[model samples]
Target: MGHARANGDRRVHHRVDLDGRAVVFQRGAHVGQYALENLSAGGAFISGERELRPGHLVHVLIDFAAGNPPMSMTGSIHRVREADNGVSLAIRFPVLSADQEDAIQDAVLRTLLRREEQAARLPLLVFEPRPRVRQEIEAEIRSFGLPVTSVESLDEAVRELEGEEVEYAGLVIHSATHDRASMEVVEFFARTESLQTIILPEPDGELNDMAKRLSTLPHVSVPRIWSRSELRRALRN
Candidate 1:
């Protein structure tokens, strides 16, 4: 059978302000209507009374305003922030057929093009540089049996991630030396497909804040070592 065709010329490459679209947020047999605002490859930003926290999986249905039939898919809320005097969710959709995937990609590209056009006239924000901490951190990563590539710059790290063939199940990011840089590494792995991430607290640094923040992320697997053995047994069973 051929992949299903999306109805009508509802352009997927453009952001349709979903304020009036018939959007539904659902988990299992439960369902509720949500105010869907924007959509892209990253996810849908929605507002709802339901407690849709980050990392919670749900099904979404959207009907284009121009009489196109509804498109539906499963999605996970990856980020949440308060807006419109209410909660706003960033939902990431996975598991789409080729046609659906293309539609989403086209939409995202269009949105990005618009953003770039606007940003061309605005000043870009830059951050302070990350200090050198490769040698000190490499030793700790090695002890975990993970391979190490000690790069002096984020540019090098990005290149390595794009080309490196290392088979790592998880990446442990240390908050040593450079705080912003360490979190940047964590964000990189989190965005990478199929890669798991564990944020290791800075050995010499305080853990109270890190522990609180890490506890909230779903992609983050805690007690990293403990999960490994448990996962193996679960798979076997």
Candidate 2:
């Protein structure tokens, strides 16, 4: 649902991209369900409902993975925004106990660790058409400590992939699998069997059917937001 810290970002903790359903509550009553976008030890952001306000205290149950029990937490809404599709929430948690903080931080760390392990110790290729958007995303990738080669067109990415001098960690793009050209490249990634890829839908977009299917592949990640690129830098162990 979003990207992370640019320059001058004062956030003390780094956020990891997470996919989950948040059952929200207020005043000890069930409120509604929302999509959990990203999370850190300090707080998290959720999108999809318009019935909340800043400073509102909420209790949430996060059903993150299939097998694990939902995590319950209490937080205060620090900010809110009206997005192209719906309202987004910024929830700030108060100071947690050492054990509580450790558990939360450890969980967030594992998410980034898992993603990087899938495409570790190698460079990355980012394909984006818009110059401004590409630059913003480029900086975000670099923040993760991966060497990135950003291209403005698919043709450029094609040439880079065909070359033998560099082995890429993965391919990052913002597109749906329904697009013929995009599908072809992702097919190539699967065919190669050695590459990994990440697909981020357009800012105001939802994932297409084919994209969801392709996400089942081990080398593919279809997360709505970029994983915390600054976990190591921002989190204190």
lDDT values for all models: 0.52, 0.71
- Candidate 2: misplaced stretches above 4 Å? 1-11, 66-69, 120-237
TM-score of the candidate numbered 2? 0.48
lDDT (tens digit, per residue) of candidate 2 on 1-237: 132432113236778777677888899998888898988767888998565889999998887752334678889999999976788898988755555566666667666776666556667787888888678767877775667888877778888888998878777776642366766777677667546677766555466766666667777766554444322221111
The residue pairs that clash in candidate 2, if any, are 1-224
C-alpha displacement of 83 in model 1, angstroms? Answer: 2.2
| Per-prediction TM-score | 0.36, 0.48
How far does residue 29 in candidate 2 sit from its true spot (Å)?
2.1
Residue 118, candidate 1: C-alpha displacement in angstroms: 20
Best by TM-score: 2
